[model samples]
Each structure stands twice: as structure tokens, then as C-alpha cells.
Target chain A: MTTKMKIKTGNSGGYDVLVLAKHPMETGNRKDQKTGEMIPAHFIQTMVFSVNGTPVAQAHLNQGISANPLVGINISNAKPGDTVSVSWTDNKGESDSAETTIS
Target chain B: MKRRTFIKGSMASAALAVAAGAGLLKPTRVLAADWPEAALSADQVDAAMQAAFGSGDVTDSGDVQIKAPLQAENGAVVPIQVTTSVKADKIAIISEKNPIPMVTVLDAGDGAGGLYSIRIKMGETSPVHCVVSSGGKLLRATQEIKVTVGGCGG
Candidate 1:
């Protein structure tokens, strides 16, 4: 899946990173309108954030997270030219990563 | 040893050395604690909280703020934001009505500010709780959200 992210430097010399990911985030609790079949659970299970290739923070997510999830976090000791990257792996073993330069 | 095998073995070890030098394999483990698997999988709210923080002794605090809509048009995706001035070490989001109440957990390292925003699913109308842990104390804030359309795949 493709993911979009942005990094903005705050006045306090810290960086704020926002990530938007594209996923079904299916809870598997829903049923089909016609067949009434259960939709299998599908969602991002793990997300890792890194700065300049160094891991900084990570999150464990479940079906409770909404589709096209949005996550924002602040990082201290960050600089304007540093690269912030976010990668996620879903329960289905599918994964993707994206990066943006702090500005 | 064969030349092909020798070349491949050296290349693999070289890559490993580079990864270790960059401090990729161990820093995240030290910075972020292990995933609270038991808490996330707990079916009940109280059980989940107990597993997450050792005790569900959460009390309401004005320092914690949870911003969410009073009524959500779609339960599939409700936007929520949490901000805390309490110098929290961890922040957890819980859905009262979902089969598994615990949605996500965020651990804040030293000097890292506590600010998180994400969208979560709600099975029905329920009180969404945001729990912040700081200095061995648990502080909480909750907001009731009305779900017009159920997102539990019903």
C-alpha cells in the first residue's frame, strides 16, 4: 500500500510528523450486504517511525484504527534537513514505507 | 572455499556490520517498550486496562484532553486527537464497545512531548477513553461519541 507523510519543524526545535496511510483496516466483523458473509480482519498491525534511517518510535495498531489511518507525533532533537520515515506492516504480512524531509 | 560462496558470505556479513553500525537493530527496542499483547487482546475494558498498566486505577484529570466529535456520521472512521501536559510516559486509546477495547498504545521517551492524533473505529455509541500514564500515576479522559452508522461490519 502507498503512504503519505509530512514533517514540519516547530518553533521549539522539535519536529512534528504526520502520516496518512491507505488501507482497508477491515475489522472482519462486518457482513456482506448480499451474501451476509463475514469479511476477514485486515489492518495494519505495526508501524515504525525513523529519522535518517534511525528508528525513533513505533506503534501497534488493531482493527480499531480507521481506514486511511492518520498518525501524528512530535520528535525532539530534530533538524530541518533530517529525513523522517514511516513504515507499516499489516496483519496480512503486507508492508510499505514512505519518507519526507523535515522542513 | 568456492569463490562464489566466499563472495556471498562476505557480502552478507558486510551488510550486517553496516546495520549494526547504524544502530538500527537495538535502539528502537530500548526506546520503545515491548508491545502490550495481552492488553490489546483483552476482551473486556477493565481486563485490558489491567493488562496495560498493571492496575486500572485511572482517574479523571484536567491536564488530559481528548478531542472528538459529539456525533460521528460514520463509525468506520472517527477522528480523535489527544494532547496531555502531564509529561506522560505512555498514552493508550480504548474503545468501550469494540470487541477488543484497546485500540493503540504510544510510548513517549524522555523529553518527547505527548501529542497523538488518529482515526479509530467504533462499533456503536460508547465512551472513548484516553489514558495517560506518568510518574506511576494513571490519568484519564473520556468523550462520548454517537455513531450513526455502525462500523463493526454488522
Candidate 2:
């Protein structure tokens, strides 16, 4: 449930935020080779990005996103020392948040 | 750099100082109510489109660009980037191979330049579609990515 994130100052005076989440991102279409049963869909449904406690970007994702998904966002008003945070909630009702300082 | 300097200089006013002193720098969160849950969970592409955009009325547009690898070694970690010339208010990504075709929906806030980059899992070789919505019109672009192996189970 611990998501890793990196926030860096972009050359355009914005901040580039990258999130590496740990999840299976199951699509429910794959079958178990041994059992031949369909795997249930399990993936992040919502991801929210916030700066200084204010939401900047929000994404509603589904099973199409790859496993261990890496998402990037650009913040136009971000400063070098500001705090950029991300939180995600999956379809299974699991959620976690991670924060990093913009560098 | 010049724009940054100008912004900084213009923001150094007494009103900003007062706002900073009052701890009001944080803007309120603008959560959109148009999250298409049904579209995301829909098993078929057509059904998903119905839930997302009310209809499958997307047009092929050269203005939308999808940047992804021609061949992905790992289906579980295919990186995809999308950009559009139109002033998009929203962007959606869909993978044809996945059970749920709809992958992600991004709400581009007011005056936001349409650009998104994300990694997505592919069950197999499939065409990934990027849809941009501007002024209630949907424009789309697609790219086929060959996956060596299945990314979900294999």
C-alpha cells in the first residue's frame, strides 16, 4: 500500500510528479492456467494530486492501466520547495497516499 | 524563465502577503461529478463508450497524437503519452485487449494544456485509443502495440 513518488521542478517553471504504485492491476479477463477461472478486476479507480493541500489534478483509472502503474502530471504553479502529494483508491476499496517535496 | 520572473514579481504584492499571513494559499478542490464508473467497468467497448460519453460518436482526428512504443517487451509496463492540439477539457484512454476497455479518464482543468503520460497493462497485442473531448466533441487517435506476452497473468 506504500506508493513511491518523485517530484521535480520542470524547465517550464512547473513540477513533474511521477507516481509508482504497487498493484496487480488485474483486468479480470485473464484466466488461471491451472484452474481456468477468470481473475476478478482489481485496479486503481481514482488518483488525486494535490499541492499544498489543494487538489491540482485528478484521474479516474480502470483495469486498462498497466501493473505497477507509473503516472505523471505537470503542475503549472508549483514552486521548488512546495509539497506535492498523491493518493489513489482502487476498486477493492483500498487506498494510500504518498507525498514528496518538489525539487 | 522570463514568465516565471514576471509571475513572481506580480505575485509579490501586499494582497498576496496578507493572504499568505492568513494561511489562505491553498485553493479549494474542484472535484468533477462526471466520473463514469459504469464505463470503466463495462466489459464491451461500445457499452463503455455509452457510459463515458453517452454515445460512440468519436471522430478520427489528426490533431490528437498517441506516443507509445511500436512493440512493448513487457505488457505490464507499457508507457504511453498523449497530446492534443485542441483545447481539451477531458482525455480518456482505452485498451482494446483489456476486459474493461476504458482505462483512464483525466479531467483537464480550466485552461489546461492537454498532455498525459501513463503506463498501462495490456493483456495482449492490442490497439490503444486516446480520446480528447473539447467543447463536447470527441476526437480520437489510436496506436497498435505488439505485446510479446500477456501482461495481466503471464
Candidate 3:
């Protein structure tokens, strides 16, 4: 998944950063494109959002969670334009991460 | 290696058998093998929940709160929210009836002020279990939401 993130002041609410990923999070159950066998269930298991080595939000996910879900967080005493980092691990052990400085 | 003729013949037979049985290809959808056991039986549901979070000692300490439909119109996708009275180190949310009992577990980094909100799909009538871990101990609570029936909340 692409690692770049988008940060901006909340249009009408207080949001530090908005994270988007490029992968389809295909619950492995989807039939493979070349191979017809059912793909195993693979999805994001945990996500950690941080700023300057401090944590902001951490969510443990499950299969029932919709693919490509959006997380809106209300930060504590954090203002606009803070450097934020994100880390995620999927069930298949495909771990990848990225960071974005809030605008 | 010289058994090519016999191997090819068996391969062709196997292909024909597969093609003939193509109608039986009702592909398996997730079967959700990991769904928590609470979804199966009422007794197991209660037991699993209790095992995760003790029930009686749980007093209405503003420490924990749950948000969901008092009466969900659709069972397929019910949105629930859980917030704590105090900032927590970890938060967990689970659906009793889901193929798996533990739906979510999150470690509230030092940044977490003990507040968490997430939307989860409920496949049927069930209890939403909310547990918070702190000081090496677990605190838990549960609220039952009645789903009207579409997919999850029902």
C-alpha cells in the first residue's frame, strides 16, 4: 500500500490527519486472480498513530470491520500541523508503514 | 518419469470430473471461521463474556460507556461506540454472536486518553462486549442491542 498521508484542518471538526491506504485488504477469501482457490482471510490487525514519538490513536481490528474504513480521531491538546506517523500490520504478516506532517 | 501416458490420461479424467461437477462450485464465503463462539449458543455466549470480563463486580462507574442502537433497524451493519471515564491503556470490543467472540483489541498508546470509537458489523442479535485493560488488569462491560434484521444488528 502507498504510504503517503493527507493532513488538513477538519472541514468542520477537529481531525489531526486522515490516513488512506492503497491495498484492497482482500480478506484472502477472495478468489485469486490467476488461481481460483479461495484466498485466506487477510486483513489489518492493528494500527498505531503517533506524533513526535508519542501515541495518539491505536486500534485493534477484526474481520467484521469493513475494508478501507476511515478513522476520525479527536486529539488531546494537539493542534494543527503536527508531524504524524502511522504503522500497520496485516494478518499475512505484510507489515508496512508511512508518515505525514499535518498541514 | 516414463509414466507420462498414464499420468496424462488420469489428468484428463480429473479435468472432466471437475468440469462435470462445476455446478457444485458454491464457493465458500469466509465462513468467518474466526467469529467468537458467543454467536452460537446463549450459554456459551454468557460464559465467554464472563470469562473475558467479570460481570457482578462491574458497578456503573462512569469509567466505561457503550454506544449502539437501542433498537437497530438493520442487523448487518450496526455502528457502536465505546468511551471510558478515564483514559485507558487498551480497549477491546467484541460481538458475542459473531463467528468469533473477540472482535477488536487495541492498545491505547500513551497518547490515548481512554476514549475509543469504532463501527463493527453485527451478524445477528448479540451483546457488544467492551473491555479496557489497565495497570495489568482488565475491566469490562457489556450492553445488549436488539437488531431489527437486515444483516448484523438483527
Candidate 4:
């Protein structure tokens, strides 16, 4: 799905990594605009952040996350040119990942 | 004829299963066991705390910081940022008034520094709670965000 991500240094001199993926994040309570039918629940169930191949943070999420979810985490002691990656799996077992250098 | 067709179909299915077990396909599939389903589905804050952390004895703490807007114009997307000074292993975000109180849980590794930022959905104005699990103790901080428009559903 080619998830979009960004990594920038915060005021603490630590890397602040942000990832935004295009997803419906349906709560299953909302109705469709045209069909007027309830949309089935579909949302990212888990996300994992890794640095240089080692997982640094993991998030267990639910439908409460906003649509087109944007999540961020701070990685202390991260240096420039380090690889940062974020991957996610949805309720339907679909998964995708995005990786980039820390420059 | 029917018996022969069934045997051929079974053999084809068995061959596909063997290939899948051998890791011939991409291995990014995450098992449902990776998430805490009970906690995520809990309706009450205390129930969620117990399911996630084994206790509901969270106390207010000053070491945790929760950054959010005083009034959210669109409850569909409310930004929240959390950072804790204490040594933390896990952090959970909860909205007191939402149908499902628990929003998400973050497990911080050694280098994570107990920091997280995300956008969450709010059904109405509520106190957004940040609970941190550190050294077997639960510490919490909260901020009330007033929502002008509800975000749950129409």
C-alpha cells in the first residue's frame, strides 16, 4: 500500500517518526452515503516501529484511531542515516510496511 | 468418476497447503493473538485497565504529560501527544466518555523513551487519560478536551 512516513529530529535531539497510511478505519457504526448500509468494521489492529531492523515500539490499536491514521513516536539516541521502518496489520489480516533512512 | 475427482482435488489442496507451510509466500501476516482483544473491546475504563495491566489501581502522576487541545472543533480527529519522565514499559490512552474507553496501547522498548503521538476519535467532550505502567506501578495523567462536534457516528 506504499504507506507514507516521515522522520525528523525533535527538540530533544531525538528522532520523531511519523507514519500516515490511507485507510478507511471504519468503526462499523457509520452508514454508507449512497447505499445507507452500515459499513463493516475495518481498522488497523497493530503497528510496529523498528529502527535498523530492531523493533523499538509497538502499538495495539482499535477503531478509535482516526481515519487515515497518523501515528508518531520518539526514538532517543537515534543518529542520522539510520533506517526507520513502520509496519501495520489490519483486522482483516492485511499488512503493509514502509521504510526509509533517517536523513 | 466422482471418487476420482474428489481424490484429485484433495491432492491439489494438500500440495497448496504444503507450499504455504514452507513459506513460499510473503510472511507479513500478523496473527490475531498479537493484540489484546479483551482490553480493546472493554467498555469501561476500569475493565480495560484490568484486562490490559491486571489492575485498575492507577494513580495520578505529574511525570506524565498529555498534550491536547482545549476544544476540538472536529471530534473525528483530535491530536494527542504523550511523554513521560518516568521509566515506562507500556502506555495506554483512554477516553472516559467514549463507548469504547480504550483507544490504543503503546509498548515502549528501551530506546523509545515512553513517547507517543497520534490522532484519535472522540464521541464527545471527555477527559483524555494517559496511563503508564512503570516497574509494576500504574501512573496516570489526564486532560479534558471539549468537543464541538461528535466523532463516533451519525
lDDT of each: 0.82, 0.79, 0.59, 0.88
Q: After superposition, which runs of candidate 1 have C-alpha atoms over 4 Å from their true positions? A: A10-13, A33-36, B1-34, B111-113
**Pairs that clash in candidate 2:** A65-B121, A66-B120, A66-B121
lDDT of 2 by residue, B1-154 (tens): 9999988888788678889787566432222344567877788888887787777899999999998999999888889988777878778889987867788888766433356789987878999999888888999999999999767764
Full candidate order by TM-score, most accurate first: 4, 1, 2, 3
lDDT of 4 by residue, B1-154 (tens): 9999999999999999999997554343334656988888899998999999999998999999998999999999999999988878899999999888999999889778557898999999999999999999999999999999999996
**lDDT tens digits, residue span B46-107, model 3:** 55445434442333345677877877776545666666656677666778776555666556
TM-score for the A-chain in each candidate structure: 0.93, 0.92, 0.73, 0.92
Of 1 and 4, the candidate ranking higher by lDDT? 4
Off by over 4 Å in 4: B1-31
Which one wins by TM-score: 1 or 3?
A: 1
**Top lDDT: which candidate number?**
4
True contacts kept of each: 0.56, 0.51, 0.32, 0.72
Candidate with best TM-score = 4
Better of 1 and 4 by TM-score: 4
CAPRI accuracy category, model 1: acceptable
Better of 2 and 3 by DockQ: 3
Task: Output the lDDT of residue A4, model 1.
Answer: 97
iRMS, candidate 3, in Å: value is: 6.5
Each model's DockQ? 0.26, 0.21, 0.27, 0.45
